[model samples]
Target: MKKILYLLLLVSIMTSCGEYNKILKSTDYEAKYEYAKNAFEKKKYTQAYTLLEELVTIFKGTDKAEESLYLLARSHYLNKDYETSGQYFTHYYTHYPKGQYTELARFYAGYGYYLNSPEAKLDQSGTYKAIDEMQRFLDYFPHSERAKEAQDVIFELQDKLVYKELLNSQLYYNLGNYMGNNYQSAVITAQNAIKEYPYSKYKEALSMIILKAKFQEASQSVYEKKADRFRDVIDEYYSFINDYPDGPNAKEAKDIFRVANKYVKE
Candidate 1:
């Protein structure tokens, strides 16, 4: 009887062990999820992106779907696929607005756009978009822990845009007639640059461009028309003084204004 009982207990232990092994294999959801995580932990970003994407798709509608979506976005981000990562974050935010990870999604979406901003010499449309998105994040999540980081990014992007505008204006000025066939375009470009980037350090240079362009335009005018054109130069000089009362250019602008006013039309 003891032998019989011992045999039954051994069978029970063996059955339980087999069932547990089956549980390990059949519950592929966690295994797949872990596999992707392990790859990410090992810094295999590309592999992680692929595996996580697959895991999310297959596990759609499961309890872990939200987590899978978040992980998928992170995988793409870790792989430096900022455009794709941004898209996924946007998708996540739209689908799960109140999810636990919603704030993270918004932050990553804004950050992705920030990271994707083109070089300073290129068009700043993307940079402006980043700034707008980040500002929106701050406005919506004012009390969020990520608010300070978002503000910092917005400031940095704004600085980049200001710098870009200044460079463009200066380039137009340096290129002279080669940049545009007429002085009007150059003057207009410089003026617009100043208006667009009021905080830029290159305001003086922009003022100089406008002043020089107007002077040249006035000099090229014909007969009595020259006086009318010279008046435009004088007006611009005054405008410069009004905007910059104490800068290094202020005195220079005043001198130019004095000289330019003498040529004004009656």
Candidate 2:
């Protein structure tokens, strides 16, 4: 019985392959379209993409154009060619506007970029593009079933951007007074990140970096500037403690504040 089943499966595979090869060489566009749809449904994305790639252009002014274009984008997406899929999806929505697949095209275009977003330490152009596309999806489809998911992706991408900035700020802080006043640059970077993403998960970390940077800056200042610089550290320490009394860096912040306080008068 198992042998019979195996034989049947072999025959089925051979027949399917034969039919696919015939379709691949056929000149009948309608036959290619139907086979492509079936191929896509069966998860044969490469075959579907090949057929749909040609049909999308061939059927440009025909009734099948919209579906062919959308299927082409979906085929690339399913094949994990997210960058190409994103471009095709963008093309579909721009040309169709009100086509049947516009909503999905917009959603996937952004989601494709989201899927393709690189590590935080890498270049973040893709992350930025993902956020922009997802925001546009939200603007156009506020009540979509995917709206909440899109918003979540946007927040996650924003977090990645914040993380990159945090790394840059830390790098600057670590370079304190080697050649230039990097502590000040660290403070600026952290402060700007805080202002730009007030609700980021990295907000506390950024604030802590600012406080640390200010403390380091004060500690390395000239004798004539020491008192005023220490005052700045004290103020920053207060701000940090007020926001996060029990934060991970609270103890470290307190240690800096203790040293900074000796320079300030009552």
Candidate 3:
């Protein structure tokens, strides 16, 4: 019985492959197009896009062109070939501005990149592209049903960028005064991150970094500059504590504040 089932399964697979090959080699465009649509519906994304890629060009200027292009893009997206999908999606909307699937094409174009966005530790070009594309979608379709989702994606990608900057700031802070005053660099990077993403979830963390970097910078300064630098640290501590009275880093912040105050006992 198991042998029979195995033979049956192998035969079914062979038949399916043979049918796909026949359709792929066929000269009839309509049959190929219909088969591609069916393949996509069945979630055979690679097969669907392989056929649709050809039909999109063949059907250009015809009624099938719009849908063929959109389907091709959608197939790539579902296949997780996001970079390729983004290109095809962009092409679809550009050529079919008023086409039936334009709205979806736009949304997927950006959302695909969002899915492709790398980790915060990696280069953020893809993340930036995702945010830019999502913003463009909002501008074009503010009332679109997908508008809320697009906006949310943009915010999420922006937060990723802020987090990347936070990592850089932390790196600088950890380096301390190695070779030069990386603590100041840390403070600057953290400050810029705060200014750019004031509402980020990382905002409190950034503020804490600023306060900590200022403390370190003051601690390492020459005796003549220590008093003035510590005063800056005290001011940063107040700003941090004011915004985040119960922030996660409050205890360490208090310790820094105490040390900073002791230094400036003028």
Candidate 4:
């Protein structure tokens, strides 16, 4: 008897919930808009999204339509639905440029992409997109309060990009070392440092190390070799001196070249 009563009560509650859902779905714009606004104010983002989406569609040409659309985007953002939020924020910016929430929408659009960016070791599609949008914001609103914050975010993302590139170059250097063919490695490392960090105070020091490592590796092969192998070392020294004419390594490379040339040819 008690089990039968519980079953009946469960069915009745489910039917009531179904009827309430139908009523909510059939509500008019004024009803939906007020509900959405109240839900948003109370921080009920999921409920707000459902109501505002309905209100925006039903109130199409009215001023509230634009506000409803903007609120719908914000609701998704507050719910941490970043990709969906980004899409709706983009729509709001495009369709309602002069809307009251335009600047906030633009700010959040970039912020949403930034929040969605992957780890530094992963693909940086979101990072790059956020950078582009944030830069536009800074350019369009140089005096805005968010400009400095935008610039800071740009610098942080840029540093991640730089670190990733440096890691790749370092890998190449490591591969070159493992092959005991430091010549190519040294050249690649020096070129990478110049290309990626030309302003680095360490650039000259890095170039010097590449030259030294290449010369040392070749010369070690030079001294511990038979006649034919000795010739290869002498040729390398000649190449090094010709490539770096005025560096400290150039003078040493020249001296090694002359001695190798004389003995190897004899």
lDDT of each: 0.77, 0.94, 0.92, 0.72
Window of ten residues with lowest summed lDDT in model 4: 200-209
List, residue by residue over 1-266, the lDDT tens digit for candidate 2: 99999999999999998998999899999999999999999999999999999999989998799999999999999999999999999999999998899999999999999999999999999999999999999999999999999999999999999999999999999999879999999999999999999999999999999998888888888888989999999999899899999999999999999899988763
- Best-to-worst ranking by lDDT: 2, 3, 1, 4
TM-score of each: 0.76, 0.94, 0.98, 0.64
| Model 4: how far residue 57 lies from native, Å | 2.1
Put the candidates in TM-score order, highest first: 3, 2, 1, 4
Whole-model lDDT, candidate 1? 0.77
> Which whole-number lDDT from 0 to 100 does residue 74 have in model 2?
96
Q: Pick the candidate with the highest TM-score.
A: 3
lDDT of 3 by residue, 96-137 (tens): 888898889889999999999999999999999999889988
Error of 2 at 159 (Å): 0.4
TM-score of 4: 0.64
Off by over 4 Å in 2: 1-14
RMSD of 3: 0.9
Winning model by lDDT: 2
Superposed model 3: Cα runs more than 4 Å off = none
